[model samples]
Target: MIKSCAVLGEQFVFRSLKEIMAKANEARSGDELARIAASSMKERMAAKQVLANLMLKEIREYPVLSPEQDDVSALIEEQVHEEIFKVIQNWTVADLREYVLEDQHEGADLLYIAKGLTSEMIAAVTKIMSNLDLIQAASKIEVKTTCQTTIGMKGVLASRAQPNHPSDNLAGMRASLYEALSYGIGDAVIGINPVIDTTENIYALLNETKSIIDEFQIPTQNCVLAHVTTQMRAIEKGASADLIFQSLAGTQAGNESFGISLSMLKEATALINEKGTAVGPHRWYFETGQGSELSAEAHYDIDQVTLEARCYGLARQFNPFLVNTVVGFIGPEYLYDSKQVTRAGLEDHFMGKMHGLPMGVDVCYTNHMNVDQNDMDNLSMLLGTAGVNFVIGVPMADDCMLNYQSLSYHDIATVRRILNQGPISIFKQWLEEYGIMENNRFTSKAGDPSIFMNGVLGGMK
Candidate 1:
């Protein structure tokens, strides 16, 4: 019975090969024949080489799996899937062609064999491919890994700290906070100031901070190093109530004396001019204290100049690059109307007024309120519209447990449902009809036989 089965298999193989050869011959062109022969030879050689190499490597790596060992053959058969994966890695058409043609052995196959490797093996191959600049690749990998790992979490805050002054002895803290209802971890480190601050203590703090960062090496991509003195000076000097508002126009007496001083404004402007350019790509938030006497309209007008000055200072310093500036309304009343402020309004008021600013510059009018989905969506849309290159915002933490009402997955499903019901739903229905969304999430373990069919054959239209 075994002999008869072997004979039948050989006959089937011969018939298939003959059919392929006959089809190639019927093409009736020298080029077609050459192409057919090359393809056929390449496929056969690749398969044979892959099979031989896998067997040899397996024997060397796992000597105990030798056929001589009891049940070893059965174990090997059981590991056929892994063996197939291993074989495919070094089974290149070029390697096969060279071997079949009796050419000198080249190590090309070994260099490119990575696709079927484990994650650790893949990392090793990537390290090799990066040509020893592994840190840069590692940094990129770390960022991607961290992002994926921490997806769907909330209230995760990250910031980079810099020295208060270049010459200051104390280090600055660059910190990130990931919070959950039950637990929280604050990743904080001190780092050296790349730029000098006005005070020597700030500078010292920066150096100390750098040492801390070097020691801890927290893996994060989003960071900021700011010079607060410059931002402070800019707000002080840029706009004064006496110049803009008539109510405090006199030799500002009593509580009205709360208006900005010229000397302070000058210092602020100089600080902004000096440091705004020096500190690169940071969300600089300026906190100010204005007396309660000022109306919302009056306060906004004055604050707008402060915002512009910081933006202009950075733009002037960078000369063609945009820097992100955020003005923080610190007091309770300052943020009282923030919920009413739309992203569109802020963009129109601030970003639109600034000419020749780098496209990435953003003015976040943040108050005490924690950022919500509406905030994120609006910001995302604005960033999309502006063609900004980078954005700094808090990413959700992984451990954040959410109530059903607050979950985004439900929102996605609802959007899908709405699409299903409306005339515009045709596109969504078409996607389902054509199985794009289903195919994307389809898994073989779930017993979706169509997944195997769609993969092996072209998927259904």
Candidate 2:
């Protein structure tokens, strides 16, 4: 394999594709912490140059994590279309980049070629692309999936109303959800991060949210983010959940650390399809972030970007209704600052879309990170402009249960207005009927949670 290259007359040698991939990534704290990052800017440039010249076949043959050792890798190998792979086998990573960005190439073209590409091949081009390159390329792709409703339409932007509570107080959650629905959010799903993870608690949350949806005739789904097994148990107990939620990682070991396996995911999918309340072939809602494998000490010396892309690789097999990257939730240890968080956000979105997964982003940050609401705003707007399928919305941008700051209901509304986009068509019609939104814009009644308490929402009072 080609493992060496020259830049500015200085020769650089990489030990393997893993090392090249790690060094070629834009600087991140996790890579530095893992001691796998390039020592200097010039060395990083050298790695990128070497990676750009390698043929797609060479990269695919030298899988960073072997199929024999990891089921995730094996599944990715099984999913790649061999015939399509043969057509582009000889292309260089640089050639692939140019092809994706070519003026005449459209979303369908990228989605077609994506069938042939491995996650490593996708990560290779990402390492050499600029931030805007990620945005522009991702903007062209539209990945749509259905649960209770379809998201990811070209002119539509959906949102998940995350009305999280620290103590699992039903009233507090319902209050937050009322505010969310008033602003035309929750079109993606009315999801919550419960302070408790027990099956009983999750069932209660799901039932409560479902009751609200049923009473108001809201056209969206509901989910309670919990351990997959716990969610499955709750579903078995007759919770009317439209989607099942779980956090995912790139490697088998990392997934084990999360207490999940491919088999477990398959079983959950089967259970949901048979017992769940959604009218769909798609039902899983997955979350991934960079550095998760590293955090679990399961990265196998691969870069976070590549590992993150592998998460998408595994997710593609599931045909998920929503796959989100909680891009900044892991803290400054991985992203470091607004700059790194913003870059990782765009990279994750582009990589997920490239994999043909219906992708969304929880453009968020924890308190310890060197990021602020303004940074979240920047990323949210960028992701929205890139045609993100949906985003997470919490009350006032603060989540009591998770203790992180995500985009607010107001923020999602503002982004939709600025981008000239609306929610899923069915949810939009419901909002119009409730006088919350009209002609694709918020009405005077929007943002007034009391609109629900005053018996306007189908006489709930």
136-186 in candidate 1: lDDT tens per residue? Answer: 221111110021012101111212112123233232122212111001111
lDDT of 2 by residue, 246-358 (tens): 99999999999999999999999999999999998789999999999999999988889999999999999999999999999989999999999999999999999999999
Count of backbone clashes, every candidate in sequence: 31, 0
Quote the positional error of residue 411 for candidate 1 in Å.
17
Candidate achieving the largest TM-score: 2
Candidate 2 lDDT (Cα, whole model)? 0.93
Global Cα RMSD, each model: 29.7, 1.2
Once model 2 is optimally superposed onto the true structure by TM-score, how far is the C-alpha of residue 112 displaced, in angstroms?
0.5
Best-fitting candidate, measured by lDDT?
Answer: 2
Among all windows of 10 consecutive residues in model 1, the one with the lowest summed lDDT is 241-250
Clashing pairs in 2: none
Per-model lDDT = 0.26, 0.93
